[model samples]
Target: MSTAHTALIVPPRLGEPLRVVPVEGPDSLKDLLGGDFESVARGDWHLYLNAEGTTGDLPANLRAAQLMHDCGLDLAGAARGPAVILGRDAKGKDTNIPEHLLRRAEELFGTPQAA
Candidate 1:
């Protein structure tokens, strides 16, 4: 089994600040993503999302996509709802999503913007 620090990105409501919460373990996945979950590969990272995000209340996560894009990470598809980003190590086991990337995301989207 792989152990890595996971980063959670919950798309903000209109005019709200972007949410960047750190996920501790697999147990929290259910709490954050709800009942079911799915994963998408974005560059070297795997992005996990709520399986029902499309049919549920989740909106298009433009800020997240922008954050990844700004960090020079290639996006495989559009993101929706809350998301979790995790990386794989040399042994192909889950590892921490780079600290710099998470830091950059917080610096850029952690606060609310001026109208």
Candidate 2:
């Protein structure tokens, strides 16, 4: 199969910035099925983002997003505003401040909240 992978950096919000990660290899398909990421129905391309990597290079979000677009990856399901759910915070926690954030993420991302 083509090694070309798909990357995504959802629009971030007040909490922190998310890493622009690309999915590939074996787990890539599983991640798409709601394994590693939460499913977002915002648009097309099956929007699913990691719950961690918010403290990543904040400035790179747009650039990475643009790269995804250039790579012919689907982004219609991407968030128009700041991102909501992340794999975890810089410290490796499931959610961030404003406890409701997790709930909102669960609601929108369509995944069960972490324990």
Candidate 3:
């Protein structure tokens, strides 16, 4: 069975002053995504961050598609935005894709991890 953990892939064009926050479950994301989780899931389906302090092999994508396709932003313009942000437990405070579970997600999504 594939465990269903959520992730947030911010657009590559978002501006600075972006802060990582503890989001709830799919509902929170759905709310932010205007109730279209499928778009977020299928819109390139890329996670660009490399989980820290890990020895396991990571993905080696020379290029990845847009991180956001449903955020209603001109992706081409947000080139300087943060690359990616995965989900984690976040100490049970909010939704998160823990670094430990990152490899699993990588395998599931087939997205190359960041160097």
Please give, for residues 62-102, the per-residue lDDT of candidate 2 as tens digits: 42244335435555534233332223345533322223433
Off by over 4 Å in 2: 11-13, 29-44, 49-115
Model number with the top lDDT: 1
Per residue, candidate 1 scores C-alpha lDDT tens digits across 6-113 of 564545344556444556666666677665787755445666777887688677777666776775755444566666666656665456676666676678767422
- lDDT scores of the candidates, listed in order: 0.62, 0.37, 0.35
lDDT tens digits, residue span 20-92, model 3: 3444455545543333332212222333332220222332222123323322333343233223444423243
**Model 3, C-alpha of 102: deviation from truth (Å):** 10
**Residue 61 CA error for candidate 2 (Å)?**
16
TM-score of 2: 0.25
- The count of residue-pair clashes in candidate 2 stands at 13
Candidate 1's error at 36, in angstroms? 1.4
Q: Arrange candidates by lDDT, highest first: which order?
A: 1, 2, 3
TM-score of each: 0.64, 0.25, 0.29
Model 3 global lDDT (CA atoms, 0 to 1):
0.35
Off by over 4 Å in 3: 1-9, 16-18, 39-85, 88-95, 100-115
